[model samples]
Target: MIRSPRGVEDILPSQVSQYQWIEKEASSLFSLYGYEEVRTPIFERAELFLRSLGEETDAGKQMYIFQDKKGRRLALRPEATAPVVRAYLQHNLYGKTREWRVYYLGSMFRYERPQAGRYREFRQIGIEAIGEGSPYLDVEIIEMAHQFFKRVGLDKVELQLNSIGCRKCRPFYEEKLKEYLKKNMDRLCPTCQRRYQYNVLRVLDCKNENCQLVIREAPWIGEYLCEDCSSHFQSVKEGLKALGIKFQINPHLVRGLDYYTRTIFEIISPVLGAQNAICSGGRYDDLIEELGGPSVPAMGFAMGVERVLLALREEKKGIPYKRLPLIYIATLGREGWRAGYELANLLRLKEIRVQLNTSKRKLSSQLSFAAKRGIRWVMILGEEEVKKRRVILRDMNSGTQKELEWEKLEENIEEIKS
Candidate 1:
């Protein structure tokens, strides 16, 4: 038998209810923030990720790259923000509104070692607010994310916040950080040593124990932020405080993206050990212009649906599944099967959840199958019932039965279930 590729999971029927619940709750919550949904392709030109995520980032390194028949390079999207920005420019959405608010839910592909909440193929629910630069908007987005976690039944989630500084002062901070790293070069990890030459700030995000030790005393970006960035950061904190959204300022909290600027944050849950971040994003004030669009400030975040589900499981939270069929039609001969099929469609037209048994099984076997599946109501259609133009509806829960005329079945559907 052929097997699925490693690190990808099949969302089987037994487990799909949880994902459905998450999607529904996400749509509802996003709508409350005036964020309409947008969808982009699953793949795009490889240059998009390389340019947006940067050459040294893990997404650019781990993306699934391939060539089409025409030899054009393309990659399965490893994240959604770049694609969303591309769509915004391609459609000239910025022309309509000063701030375009949109959300997306889809699968993202990456090549990585599979672990507890991480997968090679994963799902992300994200929202983007483009064309706005106000610190109030920043606080609003953070509060919206917090509200989403609450609606999803998550608790003990820490909002780790930071300001990576913008281009104005980041150059100075980089020089200082490079100097620090150089003085402690021997204590740095080999990866940090290599990254120091290309992306020095990444060393602060390094997970290596020794590199972390070296990073502890490194100059903080907050100290070097220009006057504009400093004021904006302070205003964002004040706004968060006004809204009662608790956050911790982590100087080392540089998110894993090249586009982020000014403000960055990660929502970490203790339920996911080691890989604790369930959602992360930040302000990318220059990304829109970098992508060839007009200068537009944008900020958005993506939540790992798999990690959220894992957190929910660890919390033992109960997510209600979609309602099951209220009635099942079990037919006995060819004539009964024909009548049952017709009745099933009629009931369905009236918005009733009915399951029609299509098997050529005996009446007793059909009823047994329905019972085993926990179906509450079973409508029996046999030769006698077909001739009489009526159905015998049995209540599985109460072991009660009632006969109803064909013409009255639609009108009595509610009463029959009760």
Candidate 2:
């Protein structure tokens, strides 16, 4: 027998309802905020990620990179933000406008050790606000995430936010951080020493226990924010407060991506163990120009669907699970089949969910199958009922049966809808 590849999954029909619930809730919320949907290729030029997500992060370090027949380096997207920004530039999405709002739901690929809620292939729902760089836009996106979690019943998740200072102040802070690390280089881990030269900001996220200890006292970048960047960070906080959104400022929340500038955030849930962040995003004011497009500012966030399912399961909030079919048409013999098919077609034309049995099983067996699939009503179409131009509709829930002529089925569906 053949086996499926590692790190990928098949979402079965039984679980699709939960998936739909999350997507619908998120889609409705994003639409309410005026963010339209956008989609991009699952793969792109490898350089897109190498240049945008940062050359030093884990995604860049561990992505699934391969050469196509044309010998162009291509990679399955490890994250969505870069590609969205790539599209924004490629299509001139910003054009003369100062801003645009976009959202997407799709799967992302990464080659990593699969453990707990993390996977080699995962689903992500993300949003990007590009063009304008107001701190208010930053606050708006963050609030959207907060409210998304709140509405999804994961209200316990905490919002950890920080400002990673832009190009102007980041370099100065990096120098200071390197100097601080230099004094304790021996005490620092090898990775920290390597990061000290190129991207020391990432050294703070190191998982090595001793490395964390060495950098525990290291200077935080927030303290050294230049005046303009500092003011922007302050306004972001005030805006969050104005919207009644509470947050904890963490000086070390430098996200793994390099393009991110100024504000960064993570909506973390403690119930999920080390894999805590359910949703996260930040600002990248220079990413547009960096992609060789017009200079524009953007902010966005991504939520992992698989990780969220884990948290939702832990919270024990009941997602409605029902087999609420609109109508079920049961057929017995040749003549009944024709009538059942006609009735099924009519109900479907009226936009009703209708199921017809094609099996040769006994009436008992067909009824059992309908009940198992949660078919709410069963319209028995035996020869006798077909001859009368009527069908016996039985409410599987109440076991109540009534004879409804063909014309009355549409009305019955309306009553069900009501």
Candidate 3:
């Protein structure tokens, strides 16, 4: 038996319903917030990730890079934000609107050690609001994310918020941080040391015990935020408060992506323990410009689908899989089979889920198959029933059945099920 690649999952039929339920809830909810769905290619130029996520970032290093037939380097998108921004510029959407509100649900590829609720091929449901610099938009995005978890029945998800300054003032904070790190070099982890050299902001988010201690006392960017960023951060807090969306101000909340500037946040649930950030995103005011586009301010976040599901399970929440009532047609000989096939089509037109029997098995075997599949309703069309212009609707649950006139089959199925 051939096995799937490491760190990937098949999303078997048993689990698909949970995913569908989540996606449906997301699509329905996001649409109400003026976020249209957008889908981009699964892969893009490898340089896109390098430029957007930074070469030192975790997403950057874990990208699934490959060369195309034309020898152009490409990578399966490690995240969707970069690709969404790319499409926003490629299609010149900026010319059409002051801001673009869009949501996406898709797979993101990354190479990492497979852990619980994390995978190399994981699904993300996220939304991006590009254009404008109003802090109200930030509040809306954050509230919308909070609403998503609430609607998904997730409880106790706390939002950790921070401002990482911007181009103007971040340099000054970096200098102070560097000076602080220089004295604690021996206490830093290897990864933090390297991150300090390439991207000093990343060290604040280091998971290492020592790096976190060093970061806990390091110079926070909040104090160095420029006047404009300071005001914007204040407004975001006020707006969130106005909506009763509670959040905590964390000074060491630097995101993994380098482009993120001002107002970064991660939503954590106690149920998930240490690696508990089910969703994280923030304002990348300069990302569009960095990607060779105009200075468009954008706010977005991605939620790990697998992680959310895992959290749901950890909380002992039931999966809301909507199992529609199904009617299984068990036919006997050629005559019954033909009548059953025709009746199945007619029943389906009325929006009934009909499972027409295709095998040449005995009635007992056919009924046994339906029971094993947990089909509660079975429509029996034997030779006698076909000749009598009627059929038997069996209730698998109670082992009780009733005969219905073939002419009134559709009406009877609807009436009996109800």
Candidate 4:
């Protein structure tokens, strides 16, 4: 038997209900926050990521890249924000309104060692607000994630936040951070040493045991934030507090992407242990301009749907799928087939889920299948029932049977529901 590709998963039928439940909840919440849906292709030019996500980050390093039939370098999207930003500018989303709110649900591909809640190909539900840079919007996005987890019954989430400053003050912080790392270079890891020169801010995010200790006491980004960035960061905290959402300020919480300027955050849960972040995003004021589009300030975050599902499982939460509907039609002979089809259609037109027996099994076997499938109302249409202009509605659970007039079938299904 051929196996699925490594790090990919088949979301089997049994697990689909959970996914649907999450999608429904996400749709409702996003609508409440005034975010419209936007979609982009699964693959784009490889350089789009290199230019937008940064050539230095691991996304550019470990993405699944190949030459399309036309020989243009292409890659499965490793993240959603970059593509959404592209569409925002291409379609002039920010022209009419000062800010445009959008959300997307899609798959992202990355070449990484799979573990609990992390996969090579994963689904993400993300939201982006692009146009003017407003800290109120920043808080609203953060609160949106918080509210999402609460609605989904997640109890182990932590909100870690930071400000990476902007063009003016970030350079000063980077220089200072680089100087601090240079002094401690002898104790730093090789990766930290290399990153120190190119992107010193990333050094703070190093997870190596020794490298973490080396820069444990480095200068905090919040202290170095310029006046405007400082005030904006403060407003985010105040706004979140006003909305009764709690957060923690972590000085080392800088984003790996080059485009993010301020207000980076992660909603982490301890259930996944060390790799704990389930949802993460922040402000990206320069990405639109950097990607060759007109300057537009944007902020958004992506939630790993697989990770959220795993968290749901770990927490032992239940996703409720509607019970299989009342009507299962079993036709005994060829003539009954036409009658069964007509009755099933009429019942469904009244908004009922009706399943017609496609098997040539005996009545006993047909009823057994209906019972096993949790089909409560089994409608039997033998030759006599069709001739009599009636259908036998059998209640599988109670082992009761009744004959309903053909025109009263819709009324009978409604009574069952009631």
Candidate 5:
């Protein structure tokens, strides 16, 4: 049989509850902050990413691009912010309200060299607040992310913060960076050398060890930020400080995307080693206008769902393993099978979880199957018991058994559940 494609894997039944719990936590927390949920198409017109991520950036290049029968280019969305902005503009949301707050949870596709916590098909939990430009909004977005990690019992992460300045000052810093990178051109990685010429700021986001060393001595954007951008950065810092959230300033932390401005940050889990940024986002003040909407200033962030899950596992601080309350109904004969069916339905109608055995196996074999499945309760019905309208209820955990009247068991559903 054919296997799952490389760089992609299934979220099997054993792992679904954890995803569901994370989903519920995210939905509740975002709603508490006045953010509503929005879902866009998985694939969008290919041009959207080119405009948002810039044609030379890694995200734009990694797009899984294809064409419809009519030859219109489309691609799976590599991130949610671009499509969310598209939705905002397409719906003319800016005209209706000055600010639109929305959150999204979904899969994104990127053709990448897959590794731990990174996949070709991945999921992200993100929020976009469009039309507000205050530095305080930046603080709130960052704080919300911090609170989310804490809420999920992940305390082993650190927040690394920075300001890449806006369009006004970024050029000055980029020029200085290019000048410095040229001095170390021979030492820099081949990819960084190319990036230095084409998309200069992305060179800072390079993961190559040699590149990182070169970047350490390069010009820091903070020293070159224009007065306006500097003030904005200060205000963001003050707001975060006032809220008692701790952060470390990372001078070389320019995010990989092209559209970020003024402020950017990443939440890193040391447990994940070098590729440890579990969450990242920042302000994109001009992206909406860049994509054909009114000049709107928005800020948002995205948490890599798989990365966060990995961090949780490494630290052993995730949702506890839980088996849903289940009573396995094992049948011994045809009549027992028919009665088991009725009992399962009645119990289900009472909002109880149940699994009725289909295997026509012996009683001992059935009990062994239930034990291996970790099902605590088992209702065994055989020919003799079915005739008397009574069934044996066995507690698999304690290896205890008792006979329960069929009608009594149905009336007192709590007994089976307890």
Candidate 6:
């Protein structure tokens, strides 16, 4: 038998309830925040990601790129934000509302090495708040993320926050950082050494121990924030404080995306070890304009579905599965099978959860099958019942049986089961 690809796994029947719970809870919570759902194509023009995420970032390097028959360069989306912005622009959504609050849940593709919670094809739950740049919006989005974890019963996550500054102040900080990195050039890792020239701030985000040691002494962007950025960062902190949300200021917490500006954050879960980030996002005030849309300041975040599941599993949190069918109709002979099919449809039409067994088997065998499948109630129909215009209903849990006329079955279902 052919196997699934290396980095992707099928979501089998047994594990589907967990995913369903997450999606349902997310939709309900996002709706409370006035965020409507938006879905974009799985594959978009490769240039969408290239222009939004910088060419030098890991996202750019790891994108699943290909050319279509039309010779158009395309890619499976590496992230959701860029495609959302593209959709927002193409449809002229900005003209309808000053701020567009939208959320998304979908699969994203990347060509990275497969790990415990990381995959070549991964699912993400994300939101985008466009046309607003208020410091309060930043805090609100952060609180929204925090509340989601809380609602999902994840308690071991930490929120790491930072301000990478804006265009006005970041250039000065970059210059100072470059000067310091130059002195420690010999001690820097190969990746950081390369990042030092192109995007020096990314060097602060390096995970290598030696590079982190060197980065510890480097100047922080917070120290060089211009007046406006300084005030914005302070107000964001005040907003978080007002709402009683706890966060830590991490000077080295520059997010991996190029479009990020001012505020950045990551919610880390210790359960996953090194790849512990369950969710991360920040302000990207200029991305809409950069992608050929009207100038719109936006802030959003994306949470990894796999990572969140891992955290929930480590915590031993249970996700309630959807209710099972209360009734299973078992047939004995050809006439009984025909009656079972008709009755199954009738019950379903009345909004009852009914499963009809298509296999023509002995009455004893059908009851055994229903009991093994955990079905609470089983309706046994045979040629004798059809002539009598009645059916035998058995309570699988109690082993109690009852006779009911066909006309009374719908009205008495709940009472009989009880």
Give the per-residue lDDT digits (tens) of candidate 6, residues 256-349. 8889999999999988899999999999998999999887899999999999999999888887765578799988788888998899998888
Can you tell me which runs of candidate 3 are displaced by over 4 Å? 322-325, 408-418
Off by over 4 Å in 6: 371-374, 387-390, 395-418
Candidate 6 accuracy as TM-score: 0.92
- TM-score order, best first, reads 3, 5, 1, 2, 6, 4
Q: Work out the TM-score per prediction.
A: 0.93, 0.93, 0.96, 0.92, 0.95, 0.92
For candidate 3, lDDT tens digit of each residue in 98-119? 5899999999999999988889
User: So what's the TM-score on candidate 2?
Assistant: 0.93
Q: Which pairs clash in model 5?
A: none
Q: Candidate 1 lDDT, tens digit per residue, 1-418?
A: 9999999999986578788889889989999999999999999999998999998887779999999999999999999999999999989988887578999999999999998889999999999999899899889999999999999889879999999999889999999999888899999998889888878888999999988888889999999999999999999999999999999999999887889999899999987899999999899999999999999999999999999998888888887784578789999889999999999999889788889999999888998988988888999999999999989989888888999899987667878555
User: Model 1 compared with the native: what TM-score?
Assistant: 0.93
Better of 2 and 5 by TM-score: 5
After superposing all C-alphas onto the true structure, candidate 3 shows an RMSD in angstroms of 1.6
Give the poorly placed runs of model 1, Cα more than 4 Å off.
397-418
Per-model CA lDDT versus the true structure: 0.91, 0.87, 0.91, 0.87, 0.90, 0.90
Over the full model, what C-alpha lDDT does candidate 2 score relative to the true structure?
Answer: 0.87
| lDDT digits (tens) for residues 1-418 of candidate 2 | 9877887878887677778888999999999999999999999999999998777877888788999998999999999988998887777767746577899999899988889888888999999999878898998899999989988899789999999998899999989988888888887788777887777888888878888887689898888999989999999999999999999998778888888899999999989989988999999999988888888888999999988888998888787544356677889998898888988887778777788888877888989888998878888999899898998988888999999888777677777655
Give the worst 10-residue stretch by lDDT in candidate 2. 319-328
Error of 3 at 33 (Å): 1.2
The regions of model 5 sitting more than 4 angstroms off are: 321-325, 406-418
Per-residue alpha-carbon lDDT of model 5 for 1-418, expressed as tens digits? 9999999999986677788788888889999999999999999999999889988888989999999999999999999999999999999898899799999999999999999999999999999999999998999999999999988999989999999988888888889888888889999898888898778988887888998888878878889999999999999999999999999999878888999998899999999987899999999999999999888999999999999889999998857545565899999888999999999998889888889999988989988988898888999999999999998988887899899898788554676555
Of the two candidates 1 and 5, the one with more favorable TM-score, higher being better, is 5
* Number of the candidate with higher TM-score, 1 or 6: 1
List the pairs of residues colliding in candidate 1: none
| Tens digits of lDDT, candidate 4, 1-418 | 9999999999876677678888889979999999989889999889999898777776777799999788999999999888988887778766767577889998999999998778899999999888868898898899999999999999788999999999999999888888788889999888888877666788899999998887689988888999999999999999999998888988888777778888999999878877778999999999888888787888999998988988877878776665466678998988898999998888778778889998788989999998998888899999999999998989887898999898776677668776
